[model samples]
Target: MTHTTASTTAFAPITRAACIGGGVIGGGWIARFLLAGIDVKVFDPHPDAQRIVGEVLANAERAYGLLTSVPLPPRGRLTFCATLEEAVRDAEWVQESVPERLDLKQRVLGEIDATCPAQALIGSSTSGLLPSELQTTLTHPERLFVAHPYNPVYLLPLVEIVGGRATAPATIARAKAVLDAIGMKGVVIAREIEAFVGDRLLEALWREALWLIKDDICDVETLDDVIRYSFGLRWAQMGLFQTYRIAGGEAGMRHFLAQFGPCLQWPWTKLTDVVDLDDALVEKIGAQSDEQAAGLSIRELERIRDENLVGILQALKTGHGDRGWGAGKLLGDFEARLAAQVAPAPALDITAPLELVETRVSPAWVDYNGHMTEHRYLQVFGDTTDALLRLIGVDIAYVQAGHSYYTVETHLRHLDEGKLGEELRSTCQIIAVDDKRLHVFYRLFAGPERREIATAEQMMLHVDTKAGRASPSPEPVMARLRPIALAHARLEPPAGAGGIPARRKETAAA
Candidate 1:
């Protein structure tokens, strides 16, 4: 069971990627690459390929919008190529997601290996076919390997990397590294196998479930309910072995195994056998599944599934205090990566406001009135405040040292409405400052005109967190803050700095 752990810390990101198919999995790969800011070239023979990919991309965009507050990278160019050669020619990575037939896969790999850059790594999205078989027709087969991903590949992050006999070790390493850069967990299986790891487990369970249906023990809906309500929840977070370890209780794995070892010998599962999937069984399963769906379209059901996954992943993110747990930890790490991509704070421009944050309004930020909601305005202003803090050296390390600026008061005025998908930028102005107190004003501008949509005057206090009292900020923080404050002192006071007109307040209520 040799493997590469999903703890790849350092690697170069793929600059360009190519997808050989534009179906569900291929589109997912394209969405992932594009969302990570890598341009993609795609070749799919389907007549409606663009529309299909567009729908998947739309769902992915919606899911990602609700998934995290970390500002995503700007989407890269999506090009639909007329031929596979054109798609793969300059790509740094090429993904083959054609139908799972071995002959088709070999033909595609041959074409890709012949056309793509020699260094390009090719990942086949084969659920079970051995990569060794898929690579047979390629001259440079070293780059071809099984990189199986779960369905709705945009959301679920696991990619099982199974290398063929001809595949180079470097290919496996580089593949995992690339997957990590895109916020996916890729584990390299040391030895190539028939179905790989994830699907093998799924097939075993699926087989038993089918037998139960064939024997009239339970229907498809009941089986799904049993899983979703029970171990499905545990498996999402802790996985199999770890959950069983807890069942061991005081003694752990050794005791738990001793208690349940006898159960393994019993005929509880039909793993070595499978029920015939005849027409009657198919009809029964299909009928039950239709009932379970309750007439929801595939797209509608997919949205529901994606929303549930996002909620679960987010919960995992905050599970262990603020650090995160399981895949949630990976998400937190990915978000940290995204946050790093924020342009570094520039030198303070004291004569005018410092533009602190630039972003687009997320679809979720809008209200039923079709404008950005009330609290989201504060979130943007708060982001500007955070940026200003970083500029002044009040970063995570500084706060962990027992002192931070705590906002004490705020005055906000919304001058214009914000709409979904509107481009936004926020600027910060230093109104006043001292060793222990800082006052700043923020202006939020929307669209190309940079019209002011909102403004907030905030008073913040530097505090010794451990001592529970006001404290002077460290000298490093003050060093950066002093110059900006000194330069801003020469400017005329802002017109509405401390005062709000009654008419303006009345307008806000309206």
Candidate 2:
């Protein structure tokens, strides 16, 4: 495995990163770093190292495109170093994803410690290795920590951060801060243990799953169907404790335990029993797995997995409070950070169409025709209306006060297509405003060329929620809207401003 390294150059301090292996986990680490705009130096002697990492990176890029609307920073350079020493030379953060062998890991860490800068942090990507054992050979063991990430690292946000006895508290804190910057939720393990947290739970369930298969109680497909079709979905969002708490219904967890706790004592599982992976069992599992995959290649299955994860994540991004649920909440925080980094929306530029919303056409917004679906166009335009209302102080608190703007009518005109992942922005120009009625026109633009995609003409009425009827805006609210409306009135009006869009200007897009 040969790799094509980008030209060598100075990298931003902490963002200068390195990976010592290029197999699945290593490649995933590489993808996550590069996508986070961190330069990565990967050293892997495997002849197909480049091919493997490239495939993973391709999938990661696709997943990211579907995952969020916030624009990502430019990709960092990938350098395939000739040696481990060369890879870690300038890396402030080094991740070792070599195969899980004690002697090999010790040798590699010994080599990395001797040559890498003293300030550099070393992370072991071992799923089951004790961080303490890995740190045995390191001269500066304080910097050696465990950073265990799930497969398809770019999509999944959790990374278990474990510090060995020799590892410094500051190292764990620094590692977590770095992980947070790269969009990972760094969960600190209280103690250094083998197969920390996530994998241990997964192993228990996996053991049961294998027993079910080996005992002929269910086929691989049936077992998968049972999981992916039911509790698996529940597990993704609410997770174990919360799901059980919900299962308890109105009585809650104490009641749930009273009802189902006794099942724990039943002869329910072979939790302590180890199943033999003898030839017959191995062949049986392999054949069943092959059938379960149909004709899809490993790469194909990875894509399917990514798509499902992205869909679940996107759904969760819309969950819990103003953020999301579980990993989805982490995702929401990440995007929120991305939004924060951008220059704050310049003081409501009424001089131009008020650029209110910027987003990308996510996968869910696409249709079979390979364009953004019609309703999504309306969704974007509605978002623009909401933004306008908020700018005039019709915020959540304001709405909670029994007052808000309600859209009475809307006229949308589709002018062009919005393909999946296309960059999108909306500009709103107020057309007219009175004590009770406000009319606005919005144009949706796609991509850097600022090509027009669609337009929306809308009228909204301020109402008293308690009275449930149109009402004059409070003076404070009108004070803000009136200034923008007056300024926009001075500008030339949009084409066919006051009426229905002409038939020729319409299309199936919006």
Candidate 3:
């Protein structure tokens, strides 16, 4: 697979997608696409498709929250269909994850060809199946190609796109656009080839790994450790050729290749012969895997794997700049921060009240006016209230210990429209704090101009997070909040100074 120069042209947004299988891989594909804000429809014949897919989605969401630096766009709607035809009927992209059998792929491709629109792209998730073989029976074979992604597709960033003879260059370009928008790195294969790039590399390593295990050179855990602690680190930043080039110390690729070429003929690997998947071998591998991953559930193992991948990828991204594969880095680059201007008084500490939490206006928050929508104003204000609550000892830890706060009601007056790229700052004032409920007023300001954007008045009731009941604010937290709230309360309220105030409707005349 070869990496193409980054293209400036953007493809049409992928609003709707379809998945042909609801197994692990298919479910992961669904989660990734949906979390990137594309609506998805899934088709699978299994009886527990919904339950299984839902579980996978839940795990994917958790992983996404931890791995991604930026908050994900609103999740797309997910639908389960009874048939493959129904699933792809309205989809812009059809992700085929049916079993690895060629006959089954041929059948599914034929069905997709008959049902989906001519312009839609069909992406096969087959690890090694040639695109030509998969599209042999389809009427529009050019629309079908391999978009092979690694297992646990949600975490891995690499997606190899291989085009068959009939596949159009435009189709590959469009597929690359879709992958790029969803924050995945895509490499195009110049021509369709067996096993693609990553798999071929893995196959070479696998042959050697098998030889080691067969000859009792090392156990599974030790072998994994050797790679994780050494080559894995180097590979994260540079590929095989580049790594060796550096090792040659200014001699470059030519010298490295000359030195390593002699080792190719040595009996270092058993790639020429097929390995048997006999019962004994299977049992041995399974037992070794169990021993290696002892006491860890699948979810725990997956989290560890994803975290490691994120850390390594993020480091590479930071070190290499925008050399592609910089999704998290790009997000971090786009982040803007707003800090409170006011300082703490000599007698009191203001750090608790003014600590900033970073958040972005999600695409879903934009209204028809192409600006941050109205309801979102109230939502951000609510978040401000939560921040205040936390400062005043009404935080999650407090709530979980049988104390919490609920928003009784809110009144919002939007003064100005906030659009994309507009940075928002918020300040909260405690109008009143008592035994049962607290009254707070919030001011939302826009950017460096400090223009008033909106104002919100909210009433909150303390409650128990565990018992689902109301309680008083903790005494210590209340003591800390009292001074700040009282100080703000004494200041005069600004009049129509932010942007504009909400207007009231007039009564009908008699």
Q: Pick by lDDT: which candidate is best?
A: 1
Give the Å error, residue 242, model 3.
1.3
- Candidate 2: minimum summed lDDT over ten consecutive residues — where? 1-10
1 against 3, candidate with superior TM-score: 1
Per-prediction TM-score, please?
A: 0.88, 0.74, 0.65
What do the candidate models score in CA lDDT, each in turn? 0.83, 0.82, 0.70
Best by TM-score: 1
lDDT of 3: 0.70
Clashing pairs in 2: 1-46, 1-47, 1-48
- Cα-based lDDT at residue 456, candidate 1: 91
Better of 2 and 3 by TM-score: 2
Q: Could you tell me the TM-score of candidate 3?
A: 0.65
- In candidate 2, which residue ranges exceed 4 Å CA deviation? 1-14, 34-41, 45-51, 70-87, 114-117, 241-268, 314-324, 345-366, 372-410, 418-452, 457-492, 499-510
Query: Could you give candidate 1's per-residue lDDT for residues 388-496 as a string of tens digits?
Result: 7867777656677788899988899988998877888887778777677788888888999987898898888899999999987778887888777767766666666
Cα displacement (angstroms), candidate 1, residue 474, comes to 3.6
Query: What lDDT does candidate 2 reach at residue 147?
Result: 95
Cα deviation at 155, candidate 3, in Å, is 2.3
Error of 1 at 111 (Å): 0.9
Ranking by lDDT: 1, 2, 3
Q: How close is candidate 2 to the true structure, as a TM-score?
A: 0.74
Cα deviation at 90, candidate 2, in Å, is 3.9
Q: How many clashes in candidate 2?
A: 3
